[model samples]
Target: MYLYGASGHGKVIAEIAEELNISITGFIDGNADIESILDYRVIANNADGLEGKAVISIGSNKIRKLIALRDNQFDYVKLISKKANVSKRAIVEEGTVVMMGATVNSDVQIGKHCIINTNASVDHDCMIEDYVHISPNVGLAGNVEVGEGTHIGIGACVIQGIKIGKWCTIGAGSVIIKDIPDYAVVVGNPGKVIKYNEIQKLSQ
Candidate 1:
């Protein structure tokens, strides 16, 4: 396996791969300055001629999506840390990474390229769409539905059955008790829509 994006995120994924005993061929990055990470050779801007599986180790949802869509040669692989407690009934799609100490309960469906970050708790029957990032220590109650490209920040909590819309950002340390709309930027306890992300709307 190879990791794209030779940065901090890639380093973490590399460690997860190590725990799983998966052989990492190298690291690939667009940045020419990054020569190596953790002793693995960094191939700069040359994804051509590469075969086998790879993971986009980028933290940004948009960048992950962009790379996945643009790079067609390599098959994406899901990396679930050996230390993570993922239920057998949970469905985690390709290119997704479940970090160490994360808990994914039964009947959860996590989409492609999503990040279930370290120590995050995803309760039963949750639906997490593509490119979503459930940051470290975030908690999602049972049956919560998080949309595509949405980012639930570190230590955020979402109540049961709440539907967070696409491209929304739930701020770090916030508590979400209500449903959120698309492109909304939510914060504070009980999570209010402080503002709409007009830039996201324009991009989409």
Candidate 2:
């Protein structure tokens, strides 16, 4: 599998690779012209050899897309770190990464292309929809439902049995104590709706 991103997030993902004993070919980044990520060289510019099995390490949604547009050849591979605790009852779909120190409890369903970042915990019965990103140190209590394309911020915490809507953005360090509406931007202790995301259609 190939890692797509050579800088910060890629570094973290590489550590995860080490823990899992998986072989990573190299990285794909726009910033650095440098050959190697620690020890591996950045070869295959278009990433033709590793399509559909490479792990994308792009942090933000925008950057992820940018890199994907640059070289959409590599299919992002999913990585579940060895240190992470994933229950047998949990279901994580393809192209999703469960990073190091994270815990996914029983009966949790994670959708496609989602990123469950480092140290995050998703308790039992949580349904995380597609393209959602649960950042580092985020915690979701039991039966929490996160909608599609929602990006939970770093260090955020969601209470039990809450339903966060689609395309919602939870602010960093915020505590979500209520149900969020679709396309809402939520923040602070109670996680109020600060703004609503305008829905845009992608080109076919």
TM-score of each: 0.97, 0.86
- Per-residue lDDT over 39-93 for candidate 1, one digit per residue giving the tens place of the 0 to 100 score: 9999999898897899999999988988888887889999999999999999999
Each candidate: how many clashes?
A: 0, 3
lDDT of 2 at 107: 100
* Best candidate (score: TM-score): 1
User: Cα RMSD (Å) between model 1 and the true structure?
Assistant: 1.2
Alpha-carbon runs more than 4 Å astray in model 2: 48-52, 62-76, 201-204
Alpha-carbon shift of residue 164 in model 2 (angstroms):
0.9
Looking at model 1, report the run of 10 residues with the lowest lDDT sum: 195-204
Model-by-model lDDT, in order? 0.94, 0.82
